[model samples]
Target: MSVNLNNKKESWYMFKIGLVIAFSAVLAACSGGNGTKNGEALLTYGNEAPTLTQNPKQLDLLIFGGTAGVGLETVKLALARGHKVTSVSRRPERMTLEHDNLNNVKGDFVKSESYASFIEDKDAIISAIGVDASSEKITIYSEGMKNVLKAIGSNSSTQVVTITGIGAGDSKGHGGFFYDRIVNPFLLKEDYADKTRQEAILRSSQSRWTIVRPGFLTDEISETRYRVLLDMDGVQSGDISRADVSHFLLAVVEQGAYINETVFLSN
Candidate 1:
């Protein structure tokens, strides 16, 4: 018995595709955390409230979760760049978009029905939802993300930029062994699990996706420009401001860099 060369190549490719699909399933199941299981919720931004800049345009931009912190900042940057925005959440707030290009939608990640109107015919989506304190009650980030991707896929042109933390998959340490084994394993295990799952959802989707994996997020803005590392490249960082991360999201949409790639942004 003998195998043809072309058959062998076909088998190898099929094996790789199967591996990717299996990984995607694992990623979709990783969203669980140790936060308060039930509560009204802490605002996405604790104290580092996002201040609105000018409006971008009046185009509909549906963002997931954050009303302050990074999510809010992401909206602000998008508005500043002239893109209209809306944020999907379970509890609708009275917050006003400082720019003319902003709107709001009340929705939840667990309910696909709620996300439909929010995503229909939108321009782009920038998700800043974090699995930090609110992780336990919600579905896995990737699961929620799959819902988002499906919604976008059914609708009009809608690009997506979803945020996941560093150490999400293999992006853990440009810092080497001590960081990978000790620091990441101890501090980021659960979040990374969810993140990896979320990454899988986005990567598998047909939507134009950019997974922004930033190093430790902080409230501090920098005078110097930050760096972007994509394609399994390693990047280490002490911190990156939520502001910078938001800006990076907007910039990528314009440059079309990092599309269908996992990019790590660091200080």
Candidate 2:
């Protein structure tokens, strides 16, 4: 039997078209339909937290002290990652981050009724409460944390991340001579005392809490790559950007890696 050249060419052409269609379908499935697949939404800039097993999740995040510092950065990063964020602060109008997923609430952290309602059904809570270095007597840190703990009572599934200083808990010696002996004792004595109390409150709670102790914070751009010291025995205080610390906070919430643990952050 003689083979028909035209017939063979048509068969090959049809096979090529079929292969192309199948390949395109696979790419669409992997990339997700409508930019979401199996509850994973397309992320911007990928996963900021390198430790996470998957892309960052869109969570209902309740942030205290979100007007400035690391708290502000947390709000921005969470919103950028498509997370629904509710920032509770005394001055909600001060939060300039305009995002469809961002909600600003005017509340006082020290008062349970002020911000406690926002805590219900929240996936995670990030507390960046702090006091001035020159504060003679400080109760804001401890009292605010106390209110948060009370509001989150018995919610073991709710993840909580709190930012304290290096000299707050067992990491006291890690701040070097100046921070440990002088700055902590003189400039931050009252503030550290409240932080110590705050840590104690968090430690006693049954919730999945992670306390972050970031070394001297700066306003520099984020390096993202920073050192996380689970043990502060031989560690020394270093500097890290507020942006990096906020990134780590979101990562911890996403990965749930450091549950019921306190880790020191520096770069």
Top candidate when judged by lDDT against the true structure: 2
lDDT of 2 at 118: 78
Quote model 1's TM-score. 0.69
TM-score of each predicted structure versus truth: 0.69, 0.78
Kindly list the per-residue Cα lDDT of model 2 for residues 42-156, writing each as its tens digit: 2221223345335566789999889899999999888877789999988888888888888899988799998766788888999886664543468888888777878888854
- Off-target runs (Cα >4 Å) in candidate 1 are 1-59, 94-99, 133-138, 154-156, 174-184, 222-224, 231-234
Residue-wise C-alpha lDDT for candidate 1, range 72-181, written one tens digit per residue: 88877676677767777665584445556677778777577987866778767778876542212334587788777776674445778888875777765543344466
Give stretches of model 2 more than 4 Å off.
Answer: 1-49, 52-55
- Tell me the lDDT of model 1 at 109: 75
What's model 1's overall lDDT? 0.63
**Residue 15 error, candidate 2, Å:** 84
